[model samples]
Target: MQMLDGDVVLILGGGSGLGLGVARHFISEGASVAIFEVSQTKLDALKAELGPDVLLFKGDVTSVDDLTACRQAIVDRWGRLTSLVGSQGIFDGQVPLRDVPVERVSSLFDELFHVNVLGYLLACRVFLDLLEASDGSVVLTSSVAAYAADGGGLMYTASKGAVLSAVRQLAIEFAPRVRVNGVAPGAIADSQLQGPKALGLDGVKQSDIPKEAMQEGFKRLALMPTLPTPLDYAPVYAFLASRHNKVVTGQTVLLEQGSLNRHMLSSAGVSGGIGTPLG
Candidate 1:
């Protein structure tokens, strides 16, 4: 039997990027998925493409009304929900701490926290009853930014860090009924960058992110020397959202290429300086 047969998963930001990839995988594994996307056009396109089997809702994660309505809609359709994966994220232009204006950084932080932190909390609060009924799982998509400053700016990193902490506490609070965990993924090729005509997103100038420069950035920063694809991390999410992951609650699973942790060890002035290893 398929691992996720007869399961119902509700994914936030599911119309594009890693969320879309994970949703597709769940469907393939015999699971039904409900996608909460902020874009009506993308939601419509996804529905038209994926058909009636996949539920697509146009909603913003930061709005409680939208999230509540979406959850109710899912319950109305599916009768029950077994899993939830929060994959919503926002970037604050990736500027350095010094270069970014204080107000700009503060606004970005607030926005990021509202979407990434509070959004997850709202979703979990609304769905916890249903998840408890099924004794199911909730998977949060954090990023390597939680542990490393390289993935994004300060706002993104701090928000992700909050996510990690929330996972631990939520797991403890929801124990024996529902499991909570998080995934911290490294750099991946987001489909959103395919073209200017893709998603109608704003604030990102097309000329600023040339293909060659992107490649150079990845090569210089990524530990594996190659950017990962969203599909590459899909199974990890699927496994975490399954019954088999019951014992893995409160864990922050890192899908990074082991580079972030390695960097700390390479740094000097820690425990007898550079020559000694932790062992």
Candidate 2:
């Protein structure tokens, strides 16, 4: 459809996982992308895979100076930005509030909020003018946790909640100039946010689950009964970013195959709550 042709997008955390998946999809659909991320190795990999068409910027979303530089670089390259996708976050070492030490709670919350919420705001702040120039859209990568209680600990949950609110508020504030929206992904495989032990188990262990258990668990949560990949979630972001979805601002699109609507997760009649989606 050439819906996004001639547009330029800035994707924070575009080095891997869902962000990388969306980046590839955007390039395929004929849009330029500026990837703002911290991982040099991932950036190098993306450069190898995508070549000169992709712009690579090494910046931490939590750093205002870095984010500002990224915005300026984008403007210098494309003159304006048509889309902004904030996909930066972490799932490391977040435990329940009750189990957390009082002294450590503040720092934990600070780190998560700094990266997930503040980082997004800073990026939007620096690039609002550029986005507005093109009447662009911003799509934040929120989680099912934002709407439900089953995802992360207090901090991560709170961070996601704030992310959800940010999308709505940005949409309202930016108005007709720039559309703001979000996508809440569910139960994606090969996610990067594993807990402190390298496997990073908030609840489910990716490597421990057998293939049969994996499929059944997905069936129990997703009404559509299909295993979805990071790539599966790309189309929604593309739609939200494209001119096709002109009126979709302030909405959080669900990409969980209907898992968010189910009341109970009964994999073999087990009474465990629905498993949280990773990545």
Candidate 3:
């Protein structure tokens, strides 16, 4: 049997990037898939392309009402949800704290934290009962930023650090019933990760950069030689969200290509950092 056969999984913010990749990978692994995406464009396209086989829901991850309603819909259709993978996040424009106008700091903090941190908490709360019943899993996305500097700006790093902590706390609180874990990835190829509206960078995306520049820059720092795509990171998310993950909870698996492991810095002194999105 397939590893995920019979599992009912939800990929929150699955419209694009790592979430989309996980949703598609889970399906191939034989699990039934449902995705919650805020983008209307993604919802329409996914529904048409993935067909009746994959359930698609439209909702913002930070909205309690949206998540609650989606929860009910999942129960109504599949009767149970075995896993939830939180894959929604926004970048902080990699702005230095001093460079950010003092006024924008509060708005920037709220914007990034609400989506990157609170969204995952709300999803876990909304779906706790179902997950407990099934002895399922909760996998949240963190970034290499949480551990090392230069992975993102101050706000983005703080938000991801909160997510990493939440994984540990939720694992303990949820107890033996539901497993909670996290994945901290390095620069993802083809990432659609965008910047915060508070900084007026919502229109900016990592994909807006030249792909060759992004890849080569990332390759220079990464020990793994090549940058990884969303699909390249999906299998780890899949295993964490599956029944096979019995012994792994409360810990975050760092798949950062050993980029940050270098003790020796270039003459540039970490100035050669890549600005691409880290999952």
The C-alpha RMSD in Å for every predicted model, in order, reads 4.9, 6.8, 6.6
Better of 2 and 3 by lDDT: 3
The segments of candidate 3 whose C-alpha lies over 4 angstroms from its true place after superposition are: 263-279
In candidate 1, what residue range of length 10 has the lowest lDDT sum? 193-202
By lDDT, the candidates rank as 3, 1, 2
Predictions ranked by TM-score, top down?
3, 2, 1
Alpha-carbon local distance difference test for all models: 0.80, 0.80, 0.92
lDDT of 3 by residue, 1-279 (tens): 888999999999899988898888999999999999899998998988799988899999999999999999999899999999999999987899999999989999999999999999999999999999999999999999999999899999999999999999999999999999999988888888899999999999877778899778777777785878899999999999999877999999999887876746463577646798577
* Index of the highest-lDDT prediction: 3
Q: Model 3 residue 256 lDDT?
A: 86
Query: CA shift at 74, candidate 3, in angstroms?
Result: 0.3
Candidate 2's residue-wise lDDT over 1-279, tens digit each? 575788899999988877888888888888998899888988888888889878899989988899888878887887788889998777644466788667766767777788888989998998898888888889998888787776666777788889898888988999989999999987666665534322224454333335578678777677787766778898899999988886789999867677767755354576745588566
Tens digit of per-residue lDDT, candidate 1, span 137-220: 999988888888767767677888999999999999999899899999877764342211112224463234565766676665
Residue pairs clashing in model 2 are 187-277, 194-200, 195-200, 195-201
True-structure lDDT of candidate 3: 0.92
